[model samples]
Target: MTPQQRRALDFIEQYYADRRIAPSLKEIAAHLGTKSRTRAHEAVAALVRDGHLVKTHGGRRNIAPAQIQLDRFTTAALRAELQRRETAHG
Candidate 1:
């Protein structure tokens, strides 16, 4: 994935961590410093395309992290990486 897309995913994950819920399109746009929700929606679409996140239903901010297919060892490693990054930058 591109850096911009990675950053958007990081932001989305952090938003979930911070708020204990998904962010709305407007919130995502504001967080990304974009001018419109359309851009935010686009970013979200990109993330979904890239398999980093998923949206539920068709209303509100019902987003969730995508499951990664990994062996147990790799899964632990990835979880550690996510935790480290979240703590370092979130």
Candidate 2:
């Protein structure tokens, strides 16, 4: 993920964890210390483009992680691949 996409995902995750609800673009921008909601929206759009997130019901505040139907093997493979990538780049 690009830095912006990663930041967007991090913001969404934190927002959900904190509020138990999806945040609006304005809220996200505030959380990210951005001056404009447009920047937050662009970051969210990038996340959707990368398949890490889904926008729901044609709304700006309704976003969720992409649905994944993973079997144990597939889940493990994905986890390992993500770890490998993180380790390689970090």
Candidate 3:
């Protein structure tokens, strides 16, 4: 996946973790600071097409991550990296 796509997925994952719900296209655009909601839509479409995400419940906050992506950081890896950065910066 491209970097932009990865960023969008990460934002989705974080959003799900924090809110216990999927974010909307607007939310995704806002979080990713994309040019527009249309870009967010395209990113989401790419994710769903590539099996990184799934839209469920006939289109609600049911957007969910699929089986773990192979080319991206696992949850633990992300936590470790975050901790490493915090420790370095702190």
Candidate 4:
């Protein structure tokens, strides 16, 4: 990732950590010191493409960090639940 993109991703992760929600493109643009939201959008798209971020469709605040670190206990519990399920599900 480019330095600019890394900064954007860091800001996004921090925003989500503080508010439990993703910031809007305008917020990202403001942090990035650019009036054009298109630049922010492009950075987000690149991050998503590189698997550093995830974005759900049809929402203004859908972007989030993709590699959220989980505690070992929580990871184990999630794995157990998945094993119990009959079919693979997202």
Q: Highest lDDT, which number?
A: 4
TM-score order of candidates, top first = 4, 3, 1, 2
Badly placed stretches (over 4 Å) of model 1 are: 67-90
Where is the poorest 10-residue window by lDDT in model 3?
Answer: 67-76
lDDT of each: 0.74, 0.73, 0.81, 0.82
lDDT of 3: 0.81
Q: Pairing residues by index, what is the TM-score of model 4?
A: 0.73
Which tens-of-lDDT digit does each residue in 4-77 have in candidate 3?
89999998887766554779888889888865999998888999999999877865666888864434556776
Assess the local accuracy of residue 48 in candidate 4 as a C-alpha lDDT between 0 and 100.
95
lDDT by residue for model 4 (1-90), tens = 998899899888878766657899999999999988999999999999999999867668988789753332355656665677746553
The list of candidate 3 runs beyond 4 A from truth reads 68-90
Residue pairs clashing, model 1: none
lDDT of 2 by residue, 1-90 (tens): 777667778778666645545788887788778879888888888888888788778644788767433332355666776899999999
Range of the 10 consecutive residues with the lowest summed lDDT in candidate 4: 68-77
Native-referenced Cα lDDT, model 2: 0.73
Give per-candidate clash totals: 0, 0, 0, 0
Better of 1 and 4 by lDDT: 4
